[model samples]
Target chain A: MYQFTIKPLFGTEEWELGSTGVNIAFTNSALWMMITTIVVIAFVQMGTKQQMIPGRWQVAVESLTSFIDNLVQSSIGAQGRKYIPYVFTLFIFILFGNLLGLLPLGVLGVHPFTFTSHFTVTGVLAVISFSIVLLVGFWKHGFKFFTLFVPHGTPIFMAPLIAVVEFISFMVRPFSLALRLFVAMMAGHILLEVLASFVVSGGLAGLGFGAIVSLPSMLLMIVICALELLVAGIQAYVFALLTALYINDAENLH
Target chain B: MPQISQLAETFSSQIVWLLVFFAITYFIVGRGMVPRVMDTMDRRSKQIADDISAAHAAREQADKEEEAWRARENENRARAQALISEAKAEAAAKSEKKIAAAQKRLDKKLEEADERIAASRNDALEEIETVATDATQDIVARLAGIKVAKPAAKSAVKESLANG
Candidate 1:
């Protein structure tokens, strides 16, 4: 639970914004974000060698780029090339944020923070993606973009009802997108924290009790940690995949 | 939890920094690094395509050259065959003319030999007739113990030769 807390890195808990009603602080979350940013830039910049024969790092960078390239191509067809940078940024950013949270730096007395576990962060990302979808939709089709809510072959009489349902589902996309990643990251961390407590408490009780409770809990914890790593990558893929799908809709309108 | 309780204080900072860092990452990784990689890939593919087309052109050129060489060889072979047949016919004609000339010369020589043999046979027959006349006259003179006249003896031999 303490690991989930966002504390100030220096000075007071927060700073006043020159008589404005707003307050801000440089928390561990921001520090980790900056770290993630640096890591991402260095990894990508180093990997981009532009050589005819790529080295290992360059291969890794190319593999990831091609993965997203294929994803966008499959989902959005040719026109999707324009949106690759945005979608790629979203994917790598969220992926690094998720993985950096799971780093085993606790032995070094630095508790890793998962910024992606928060609704605000995920919500902002989702909003950004959704805004792009809306912009592309409106920019391309103008008022006809509203037709997206109606099914392709709906009856005239049933169109209104279908449109209402479709509109609601369409509007839920961003919320679902944001909530899925937030809940997944938060829940896995919570489970691991609980099992860790059991390990500590059961170990303190006795060797026999430790075998019965702590051993199993520790085993389960390890399994869950492995599962969390998979989840981190899957969630990142899902985020990018869904963003491409949404962009596909905006571009193709179907 | 500070997540909910400290939301007001932290949310602004998180959003501000997230936007800041995200923009930086987007500019550096997405805009800058990615295009260079894509351009390299594009250039590589273009080079491969050019190489393939050049290879294809070379193969076609080789095929054409082989075909032309074969055609020239066949034409040369046909010309050589014609030359061989012409030389054979010319040799046959030359040999036939030489044989005919040799046969004509041999026939002329054989005719002259036949004329010569006939003349010699005539001369030999005249000499034998004269000797027979002289022998008949001498035999009559010696048996009869009388001198026979020359003209008489010659007339007697002629009469006897005619009678026989």
Candidate 2:
């Protein structure tokens, strides 16, 4: 179980940057994020160079951009277009992370087998979502953003208790958002890698029946993989939506 | 040295790496990726606007043609109305002539009936006069008066009226 679980192939383990109070290191996830950034930049910059009228690439980019735009508009309003860039970026980043994680080399444990289940990645994402919520909140409403926890339409007597509950709930947003996405992506990858190891382990006896039995598992994994893609998109959408909702609350803070 | 040597991919440490990766993605999106997407969207929208404007121009041209057709239709209707009025006048005149001819025929029939009635009236009066004269002659004969014919009685009546 230990051998199957831990695959140390990459030289990345010795090169962790720093440790915090509770003991968390940020290294591999950082590198991958940088890669995700560079990839996103290259994709957009190149996809629009010639910019043919009816070209497939341009249409695709436009379609995605507009889809998110329309979503924001319908959700909040036309005024929501101001936040389109952040939402769009969130979508693309998660999109690459989930997809690139499924890449063979990425799954194979890079540089002395750095386990990709690093919570540092999760925490970082959570913090950003957290920061954005606060930044946008304070930028627009300052102290008023905190009032969202108290909620509206509540009776005066219940206000204090409800406010405390709302505050806790508000504080949990980053954790829930980051945990949901990271858990989903990481779990799906781990399952796939595990199933792949099974097909390799059970040799000749594994050939006929093992391969046949694993067929259903492989097919199930494929379905899950496809579903994971949707989950990835949705998680990103959820994170952005929450941010927007927070921002809208701030903007409408009275 | 012990701490560095002790570095192995532990279950707990993976959480840290996850956070790091998440942060990178968030930052990349926040800084670089989002702006490019927005620019692409703005450009695409501008293209759509240009398309709509071209369509609007074409629509305007069609509208002008439609207006021209409507004007021509109106002019045709007016001309047709004038022609119809002229025809109606001619028709009315011809109908009046025919009606006058029919009235003349009706007057002639009425005059014929009047003539027939006068002749019948004269005959009835002559008969009545003859009968009255016969009755008076009979009465006079019976009471010392002589009998007279219709013509004689009529002459007597005329003579009496002249003398009176």
Candidate 3:
């Protein structure tokens, strides 16, 4: 049951720029990304007409903003204020991307796509965040930014070994960040798909035996869905928090 | 497997969309939404502070007014009490003056009555002495048949009166 597959919705038609060797094609992942963007933008726009006393929608927006604001402040310190917008964007994008997959769009003959389930999507985000850390680290500290890889107060003989290990660990930050989110989302969705297939295949066989057998799997799917919802939010928060921490490391050279 | 094999094909589109959406969200949420929400919160807190201060000022003003009213009431009461005591003292002085004048007039009238009674008593005593002397003189001339001297008769009468 490889129901978790991602396919190009438009049958793989690529638009080429003449003689430029650049092919641009709209994919299902692109569609969800655009939808996520629209939803986020609309949510922000809805909260634009704010009041001294907020309503339900405004309260939601303000709480989320303050939550991220506090996260950035604590993780990245005061200098992290400027990075709030980027961190907030990343959080909301990943959060909505994770949640959008759980919608049952298959009723309309469309397979719902979660962009975050794909490593490429998360990989780009991780690389972007990591690049900012490196760029800001180098920009602020110049050549001293490399000192971040060397642990403090190491023995003279062990310094080289520690430095190499630290450098590798530092470089692996992006891949780890990307894979953590990708695998979490991908695994949950795949598990749901496997359980759902068992229910469907069982139901197709016989009504009496199938219903009894599939009931527990159905309940387990529900439980997994609930857990997925929690994971979606937690992963987004973790991603943003880690990004801020990395930025803090770069800025403060810790 | 398809995701890994077709990574190159899907990579650019995803990145492009991600950039577009993220940039838009950053601009709107960062520049627009966040500031407005923060401003609303700030304004709300400011309004609450102002309300509390205004209430405090009003309470203080009320307390001052109440104190002033109490002080004025106390002053009016004291003035009224003074007026009452002054009126009482004035009435007492007037009654005392009336009683003293009445006593002085009564004492003068009593003295006049005493002097009139003593004068009358003295006149009555003198008359009695003259009458007694004449009676003694007549008795002596009738009984002894000797012409008694007037001075002798008078002296005899005096002696008889003294012995009696």
Q: In terms of docking quality, how is candidate 1 classified?
A: acceptable
- For residue B58, model 2's alpha carbon misses the true position, in angstroms, by 4.3
Candidate 1 Cα misplacement greater than 4 A, ranges:
A11-14, A198-202, A209-223, B73-164
Order the candidates by DockQ, highest first — what do you get? Answer: 1, 3, 2
Model 1 TM-score on a 0 to 1 scale: 0.77
Could you give candidate 2's per-residue lDDT for residues B78-129 as a string of tens digits?
A: 9999999999999999999999999999999999999999999989877766
lDDT of each residue in A1-254, candidate 1, tens digit only: 78878877863444756777455567788889889888888888866788887898988888888888889999999989988898888899999999999998998999989999988888889999999999999999999999999978899999999999999999999999999999999999999999999999999999999999999999999999999999999999999999999999999998
Q: Write the per-residue lDDT of candidate 2 for residues A207-244, one digit (tens) a residue.
A: 68666756766777678777766776676677667666
> Per-prediction TM-score, please?
0.77, 0.61, 0.75
Question: What 10-residue stretch in candidate 1 chain B is worst by lDDT?
Answer: B125-134
Docking class of 3: acceptable
TM-score of chain A of each: 0.97, 0.77, 0.94
Query: How does model 3 score on DockQ?
Result: 0.38
Could you say which candidate leads in lDDT? 1
**Fraction of the reference Cα-Cα interface contacts (below 8 Å) that each candidate reproduces:** 0.68, 0.26, 0.56
